[model samples]
Target: MSNKKKERKLAKKLLHKYRLVILNEDTFEERFAIKLTRLNVFVLTSISAILLIILTTLLIAFTPLREYIPGYASTSLKRKANELNTKTDSLQKAMLMNERYLASIKSVLTGEVKTEDFNRDSILKAARQDIDFSQVLPNRQDSLLREKVDKEDKYNLFEDNNTANFVLFPPVNGAISEAYNLEEKHYAVDIVVPVDTPVKATADGTVIFAEWTMETGYVMIIEHSQELISVYKHNASLTKTQGDLVKAGEVIAMAGNSGQFSTGPHLHFELWSKGYPVNPTNFIDFE
Candidate 1:
């Protein structure tokens, strides 16, 4: 019975009404007045607080202001990060391929390549085996064009060579011990000379490679203009280091029979054009 009486009393206090009034301070006049219950005031304040909280949450979630908060990332920033990751992967793959290519070139320069017994001409001929050469004939227009071109070139003295203005110099003057033979896979000419003979550069270029190896002894490679490259092997000593600029006919090394492949004191010289081995005798007159 006592608990029921206390509950009734609390309800009466919560339902009780109070008058709130505002008056002019000097005139003592009642300007505003309102009758409000305790329950009504509490309900109104609670509703206003809830509405303010919801508005604040919507503003942060639906607008760009969210990105300024901690642990929030912008959309454009994520896209740029993904693009950079893709580019980094591509660059890594390209760098790996370049390293492999450089390793192959190093092996060739060090004389670590294995000789193959196939002829390049034979392979090309085999590829054309199905074609009938007798059936192939030049048409009238083609023949006329060829004749006109020949006539124009017949009297022309200034023929444009693809080597630009570069002239090749003989590295050493000696009897050829071994000529370049495609069938034997010997792409370089071996010039027999006494040990410690001076080996000169063939053209104006920069030394790209200079090192010693077990199979080729002291080897030096130069990169020239016009897509030309010259290689000197079986050298007794190299006078210039890699990245050194050299002139035509400059002494770069001394020839010696210092490698496992050397028969005697000779300079194994090779010339390359556009990455293919070319006959050195075709460019420079050694004798």
Candidate 2:
């Protein structure tokens, strides 16, 4: 056999051994090859899909994505919030009272009102006649009588009599901002002092009043012999109480800006004998 023919036959045998074949027919033939098992592919695809779903769920549940969900408010939490609000409101009111008391003190010291005629009730009545409740009381006779007696007694004790011997310092060392007068209806002397200064008793007396007031803040009223009464107003705090005996120059209170009519730290000192307002400066030597 010829060498070329032998080589051609050997090549054809090698192609047949490897299952490589060429068709001579003119018709097309369909061919298919399997790469993987159907069951295996399906199982892997299902597992991947499940893992994606789980990851997405975890992100939504544990991350900021959860914020999209509306959270329900608890009644207990709401109640607590309301209570806090109420407390805050009360504190604010107290602060406002302190501010006003201080302002009133400043006004008195600056001569806004006459010390001799400064009547807190009368001023309130005149300025707020529309809101006056004095006339609406069930039994105003007692109130009127008491007021009248108080005024008369104060006037007589300070003006008509000279019974008390103990002199007093009108206020702690501070400028006399306001003086006593009767024409303008101012009935007290105002002394401007630093906040928290000590307020001393003008004379030996028993404390008749020591309490927080809307207009005067913390007030201390002392009654001495011969119907003499001294009023200390707008105290930040009181060291003495009602019925407590206090001596002249004794520390009775700490100066404060507490009251509804005060503007700053000061002592609104008033002297009364019998029942009327008296000039505190007359008895106190500021120099």
Candidate 3:
């Protein structure tokens, strides 16, 4: 027979219906009867297999049961494991440093090391023993040049405007809650004001730092011309970001008590000149 005739005969055989009957042999009565075909059985089997595969895939992808599968790990679990390892490494380093510090302290306590047993003159003489004393003194021209350089540097930072005499704008209009005290090491002035009161900048400058700290809360540092800087701390919120240029008397923050050291709503203001913390009270009046 031809190929087409063979295929047609195969299809007819597969589609040919057969009656399925169930009956009790002794009763001689049929309980059920149904018509079925080879093609129908094949299609039903294929559909069942597809549904089973879909169900298995869903269970493996979404449920924790997937962890039971071999060679499978969640991404989140790996990230957490990495974080734990990093913390452990940091803790190990800290412990090693502490152990070294303890050893040094023990050495000092046992008289194996002396922290303050040497004289200044003897130390200086021992350090200078390798050098000739004649070269220590410069010629007349060199001394003159050295003096000229020192003179120029003496008035470098405060040449145009002495920070000591520079007029500062008040950061906030409020009563002084805490006065500046050198003994207490409180270099900043604390001014009390109503909550949400605007805090102004003391001078025109670019913001060097602006962020929240555990101790100072919302703190901001501004760098002005001539080595002058202003700090505003314990603010409710900051209006400007780091590297922003701010003008004098501009509202930069709001008075608040948002830090660990704060007792009530206030603005903690500080001024610094040439890396030295200056009392804000010296420049601005809070009363």
Candidate 4:
């Protein structure tokens, strides 16, 4: 054979040793082969597996997929969640108590109960009467019983109607910022107005309290008939003093920002009836 043919044969033999076939030697057929070592295949497969695992771990840890994993949240977040649940439970309990009280009142009005024993004091009194402490201690002293009676009397006095009616000194003019909410410690409605705006009473009442407070600032309270009371706070100045009888629509004070808690010049007004605060918005017309 010629030198060229011999060299071609040697090259074809080397290619075959490396798992590569010489194609189209006599026919138009193509051949294919691979020369991968066992170590190379194993390394490639291991790297692919590691990459897949890392990607999966990242997806589960940093994405929303982590929600499927149980107990993944931090302890502080869980504690806050528990606290919110407890508050919700307490609110639900209070709502149920209010509902029951309203139902009891309705039943009494419909002649369900022998008498209207729905008031808080009356209910407590009835409960005390039904209790038999003598059974627990037959030799209970009479002095202790007398002391209990005195305590009950004092409680009754404390529960007496301390409510008063209130009058609007300034009829209308301003915007209300905050509102009265006993739960939030904001026990009055905050009315925002220009400095030195006129403050009026909603009804005729006698001023029971007129002073300055750290929270309320330049406060005034008036007591009226039917145990209704009105409070005006955060005033620039007081036009009246304690025991001063003021009529409705009378200017009792000027609106001002005198206290540290006040954000601007405004009056914080509150209304109480029978020692219980009621929503002032229900009675006053805002203008």
> Top TM-score: which candidate number?
1
Q: Cα deviation of 21 in candidate 4 (Å)?
A: 99
Worst 10 residues of 4 by lDDT: 107-116
Model 2: runs farther than 4 Å from truth? 1-165
Q: Using Cα atoms with residue i matched to residue i, what is each candidate's TM-score against the true structure?
A: 0.54, 0.44, 0.45, 0.41
For model 1, give the 10-residue run with minimal summed lDDT.
155-164
RMSD of 1: 11.4
Q: Give the range where candidate 3 is weakest over 10 consecutive residues by summed lDDT.
A: 106-115
lDDT of 2 by residue, 1-287 (tens): 69999998775654442323454457645354334444456677999999999999999777766656679455566899999999999999999997886675454433354335467898877878666678766477888998887876652334444644446655587887777767766688788899999999888899877888787798888888777778888899999988799888899999989988997888888877665567877567654
- Give candidate 4's error at residue 191 in angstroms: 1.1
Which is superior by lDDT, 1 or 4? Answer: 1
Q: Which 10 residues in a row give candidate 2 its minimum summed lDDT?
A: 14-23
Estimate, for each residue in 243-269, the C-alpha lDDT of model 1 and write its tens digit. 999999999999998878778899999
Q: What does candidate 3's lDDT look like per residue over 30-95, in tens digits?
A: 999999999998999999999999999999899998988899987888999999999999999999
Better of 2 and 4 by TM-score: 2
lDDT of 4 by residue, 19-107 (tens): 44547778857675567544556678999999999999999977877866887876666799999999999999999998985574333
User: Is candidate 2 or 3 superior in TM-score?
Assistant: 3
The superposed Cα distance between candidate 4 and the true structure at residue 31, in angstroms, equals 99
